[model samples]
Target chain A: MNAELPRRAWLRQNAAAVAGLVFGGAATAATRRAASPHRLVWQIDPKKCVQCGRCMTNCVLVPSAVKCVHNFDQCGYCRLCFGYFDPGATELTTAAENQMCPTGAIRRRFIEPPYYEYSIVEDLCTGCGKCVKGCTTFGNGSLQLQILHHRCVQCNECAIARRCPAQAIHRVPVEHAYRMKSQAASVTATWRHKEDGPAHA
Target chain B: MPKRSRIWAWSWTLVVAASVLVASGVQRFPKPDFRSGYTVPQYTPPAVERTAAREWLDVGLLTGGLVLAGYFALARRSRRGLWILSVASLVWFGLVRKGCVCPVGSIQNVVLGLVSPADGIPWTVAGIFLLPLVAALVVGRVFCAGVCPLGAIQDLVIFRWRPLPLWLRQFLGMIPPTYLAFAVANVAVGAGFWICRYDPFVGLFRRSGPAGLIALGWILLLIGTVVPRPYCRFLCPYGVLLGWCSQLSRRHLTISPDQCIQCRLCEESCPFDAIRVPTPPHPDRAAARRRMVYALVLAPAWVVLGAVAGWAAADPLAAKVHPDCALAAELRTEESTGKKEQSWETRVFRASGRPLEQAEEADRDARRRLRRAWAWAGAWVGGVFAVRRIALGRRSELADYVPDRGQCLSCGRCFAYCPREYVRLGELDGIRGQP
Candidate 1:
């Protein structure tokens, strides 16, 4: 029983120390939470994106968070796509020289003799904006870059956002994460058509 | 053929057959044929994305694990509870999470964030990195006890306890600090995440990645069967930070619940050899003081030497950080040899219409940053070594066996072995009862 006295004292001392540590930890956690903006996460607006290729290099992750997303509704289903074919292509073949994407991310398929369909092979896309730039310049802006939310760790201040020349990236509600141009354009078109009809009458 | 030679020959044949089986199993999917007209293969990208909800779940698991580890190690003192927690952590963190956003690899992220404020870190990453460290400072290395998947995997595989030689262990212990220094320096200069790149077990968890790393993981596990957390002890750069926190921990794991009877029954219970035996009184205090003074005097010189070494290696280290630097060098070589072909990276650089001088300028800038960072890292490494040497040289008096606070993982293995603890838990009667 005599040996227990010092041990109990030690325990009491340690308990106080533990209490202090817990209090300190709680205070720090509280302050960090207060300092951070918690509810929102960064996303890229497809229409606003100029495809400057900053997303490829400026992202903190080795593979950038920005990936090419196909909006089939916006696509014209052209036989010769600006996004798929090289400007100086000799033949409309699936040859390496005829491809526009530096990584061959755009895959071309033959639907019939004179028609073909194009889709983005995401794994190969480097977010270089080369294909997006081509498509936006010549064809309907069907192929666009979007932040793959799954790949994004949602940094408090995104690295790519800071470097984006067009200021395309912005924080959006998690519930409405994706900011696709096709959906926005269609909504605007219907509103425009209704406004035009009233004006004509 | 001799019996041994014949056996070796049969084993080689069996290994070849096993490799073929494994390869065939891995490639069970039908190969795509481009020649038979273009049929667009439905590309199903691997679902390895982190959602906000999933990130929260990981954070929740980490926080819960820390609390449970502390309770098991300190309050309950249940080795069984710790074992269960370890296994659960292995499944959750190792297998389910697939070893990404781990505390071990997060050290690089935190370092990178600190160095380059532009590369802002995720709050979740920051929280995951700091949580265990704060926990360690309060409750010793309870994080290592059952919370860390790396430590848990190693702890589970431990069967035969074979302690390394004192000199060898001490020498190997120095590796973590050096590793920590290099990882920080590399990241500070925008070098790739070396820790994640070389993670031995991540490949095993994902069941894909480079084969060489998988082989290394298996080898490490094989060694861990006897060595008891070889990575945690000798390699993990994060452990260096944890050890420092544990050293100043408020309330660490104790071998006895009530009193140390000095029975020494729990002496060999620790698989990691973290138990400190009772030390005799210092023979000569004056001599010890002189030795400490000498060590203090030599510490600066050691720092300078380390700085010089780091500065010298800065050029090579800088090359690793900027891909453009390596590409430029390769392009120059190809140009001098009159080779018309250009690599993909060089082609991309040229196609971008950026001046070659710009790439050179970036390389130079990266090298300058690397030199400064490497020098500081070297000095830090030197300081660590000096402190370690002094710590080793110093002698302390101990009345009873206690867990070495810095080295002890707070695993609670010794608690079950302690007679006093057994009695306190009512597992043993006070008089003439076998514990």
Candidate 2:
């Protein structure tokens, strides 16, 4: 009976060894099947963002990693840029009172008679999404917010993503990290998928 | 070529193919006809995307740290080396990275990946997750001793501690497995990664967060000064798995360099209460046999009862936690009350143009998934309890005091406390130990 006990223990040890090997093999198989060279990081889907302004305040960084980026292709370049100017502003002058951005991040440049170019000065942008709300409402929604990877001390789980009412923030492969305003049409449809690369890259 | 090599080759081919699929992401639009020679500048995103290099670096650092921690605990037998490594780990993995690239949170990715293969885990996360487990399987939890930032932070803060009473320690030991079950279940149900959501030290690492959570972190740290690694011992889900692997370790850290000298100092020094003194096998073989039989018999019953309990509680739990379920509940209340002022969630749902039927359908699906996940989780927890019971039932012979293989963090604190260890280290002369 004592000899049998040792034998049984030996068998148990071997079984455990086999189980560990099987687990390792299965994990390796899964990794091989995945074959993903890219890492996953959090980003906002522009289509899903509700302009709740949580990105402005909820980020761990002091000034927030989220910044406004213009999709120039989608820009209307309107003489009256809704994103750059406040609706309540009595005059059309480029005054601090008339500017929509809290920090005056948007710079309006004249291109032609009816075309006024708008660009985002990222450092000044607070990612407040006030301009985003105005632009989405009145313009082509060209001025949208994106998480700048430079400033983003990429947390495993983003603080803003937890409270995002839109549930817009999600993990995407590094290639799809920049879900900017222009890629809005195509990015959300396929970005989350691991097997497929982004629509363009 | 062997089958394994062929498989590897095939995977590499697929990887190359995937990379080839990458195309220029630049999208251009027709310019507004301007008489002025105003050419639109090429679009360039302000910040470069964080490369895979950094994530790979994290994997390398983690591996190196674990190896060094094991060396310090075993070969060098230096607690000072472990402490210095702990501080370094706290600075790098804890503060510099802002608590990302963590093995503890990687369990969620693994769960999520397996649950939904479409959402496969990143290769780096898989590496990070498996490394510590593999290390633990080979040697006792060297990762926990000085490498894990969470443990390191707590360990560094430990000024002095009083070991909890055995009864309290055993009772509190139940918490980690329960925490693990829920955390795994939550991810399996696709609810969310609650571990990352509720990380205690994330606020401290980031240095800016909600005031309440930061205060809670500080409170835990204060408690940590009097209780060594309260989180690791009683709460960490990863620790439960590490403990199991550690229990089955091929090699484990020894209290003494050569052999124990029957000194009580090591026991006095150990804050974690992981030391076990020598004991003879139980005298009554019949009683021991009966207890073991009872434990084996009750294990199935425990699993069944757990599953039933889990199934019963699933709906109520999901309502409180699951986003879809919460949203549905909120929407129903708003409609029934005819409330005009809508919450942010309700406003978002209404604006989504998703019909109430569709939303309710999603909620039902989430609830069903949650129930299934809970049942599996419950069964796993029950199995763990059964294993614990069986271990407790067993009677074993030991010749000397030793660190409990399952609970020991391999921190090397007990080494100095052992008089024999001093003899081995040549601090005390004329004692023959391992040359």
Candidate 3:
């Protein structure tokens, strides 16, 4: 009986060792397979974006990956820019009521009479797309929402992309990092012409 | 009173008075009017840019820390080295890194990766998640000894070494598995990482987060000072996995480098109560057999009860996990009441131009998934409890005191207390020539 007990114990120990080896090997293999270098990162396309405010709330991160990127060339430097002032604004001023951005991300500076230059405060921009919607709707889409690559942790599957109404977000090559709108030369030219009309007429 | 004590008392008083003065000075000037002509300055906060290089550097640091931990715990057998390493890890991983992409929270990422392969995981994240477990398999939980920032922070504050009753310890021990299951279920159902969301230390590491989370972090730190790694031992879902790996570790840290001399000197040395005392031979084999059989019979019953309870609570839990379900419900109530006012989420949904039925269907789908997940979670918890009960009931005789395999953190605290270890290190001369 004593001999049988030792034999049973030894058998049990060996069996456990074998089980551990098998499971550990399988786990290692699975992890290696799952961790492939050929992985796609999620990105937002500025042109396709609808600016539905989902990017801010739907992102897994507290601060969303999306941020407003300004194309200085595309901006017409208009005093009454639709992106900065609310559509229903009583006056073209930097009042809280007149601001289109909920977080006051857009900063306006007076350049000359009837002309103002606007810059985006990236920190305050919640990537809510409120200002982007305003810009796209009534003005040249100069202020567009793009995935700030530096802020993006680059999740394999973006939470916001899944919820995007426009389905604007898609995987892009790391080399072709950002999907920026081409400088809206036509829109800028037209806006400049409209401003010139008041001066010359 | 001692001179030092008096000096300390005076210093504290001065500090408190200074703080009070500062606080009073900062009181809000009662706004003269609701809309004052105060134009807020337009300034940009410094942007913290995350680069691929930085992520790789973090991974490299993690790997180096693990290697150092293994060496200190297993080869060097130096408790001081472990302490130094712990402090370094606390600074680098906790304060410097702000506790993101941590191994503790990486479990969710690994799960998400496996279940939803379409949403791939970063290589660094996978490495961070698996490296510690692999290390545990080879050399026990060296990660817990000094590499884990969470454990390091708690280890530093541990002043009291009081041991809880075995029954209480066993009961509380079940919480980690439950937490693990809950976190997995939340992730599986597409709810954001709840573990990372509620990490007690992250807020402190960042120096700022939600006020409620910061308060919770402070409270946990206070408890940790007395309880000795209350979070790691009782609540860390990741620790449960590490414990399992450590159990099957090929080579683990031993209290004595040579052999235990049965001196009983190291009994009260471990603050975490990871030491196991020798057990006498069983007197009644028949009673033990009967108890084992009884546990086996009752296991299924326990599982069923747990499942039923989970199913009953599924509705509330489901509402919490389903992203838009709760909001949609609230929107329904508002609509019924003829209220035009709507929350941002509801307004966004309305503006999306998607059919209301689609939103309702999505909510229903999420609820159904959550219900299934909760049921599984409950069963998992119940099974864990049953297994723990069964394991506790089974016992074998031991000749000497030894570190409990599952609970031992390889912290090297017990190593110093073991006289045999001192003899091995050549610090103490043995009466007989060393073997």
Give each model's whole-structure lDDT.
0.74, 0.79, 0.74
Pairs clashing in candidate 1?
none
User: Local error of candidate 2 at B382, Å?
Assistant: 2.4
Distance from true location, Cα of A163 in model 1, Å:
20
Docking class of 2: acceptable
Evaluate residue A96 in candidate 2 and report its C-alpha lDDT on the 0 to 100 scale.
97
Model 2 lDDT tens row, B1-435: 999999999999976764343222322223477789887655577555467787789899999998998889888899999989988998999888878758898877677666555566667788888888878877789999978989988887889988799778877898889878988898877677888877888789889777777887888889989988888898888898788777777677888887676756677788888888777788899999999999999999888887888787898888787888988988888889999328888899887788888879989999998998888888887788788889887876666788898899999888878777778767886454323
Q: List the residue pairs that clash in candidate 3.
A: none
List, residue by residue over B271-389, the lDDT tens digit for candidate 3: 88998888886789899889989888889987887777767777876656667576668667777987743665666567677777887888888888877887888888888888887
lDDT of 1 by residue, A1-201 (tens): 123357755865675466546534543443343223233457777766777788898775557878887765556556667788889989989898998988888887666656566888877888888888877666666677888867766543366775565557865545446656645444334434533443344
Error of 3 at A53 (Å): 8.1
Best by lDDT: 2
lDDT of 3 by residue, A64-117 (tens): 878887765456555567889888999988899999888899988765465666
Candidate 2 — what's its lDDT?
0.79
lDDT of 1 by residue, B1-435 (tens): 899999999999987886564333222112233454655433232343555788888998899999999999988889999999999998988877768778888777666555443333567777788888878877989999888988887888889886678899888998989988987787777665778767788767766545787799889999999989999999999888788778767777899987788887988899998988887767888998899899989999889988998988888755555554676676677678877336545555666677778878877887887888889999999989898889877876567788887899998889878888868878788663332
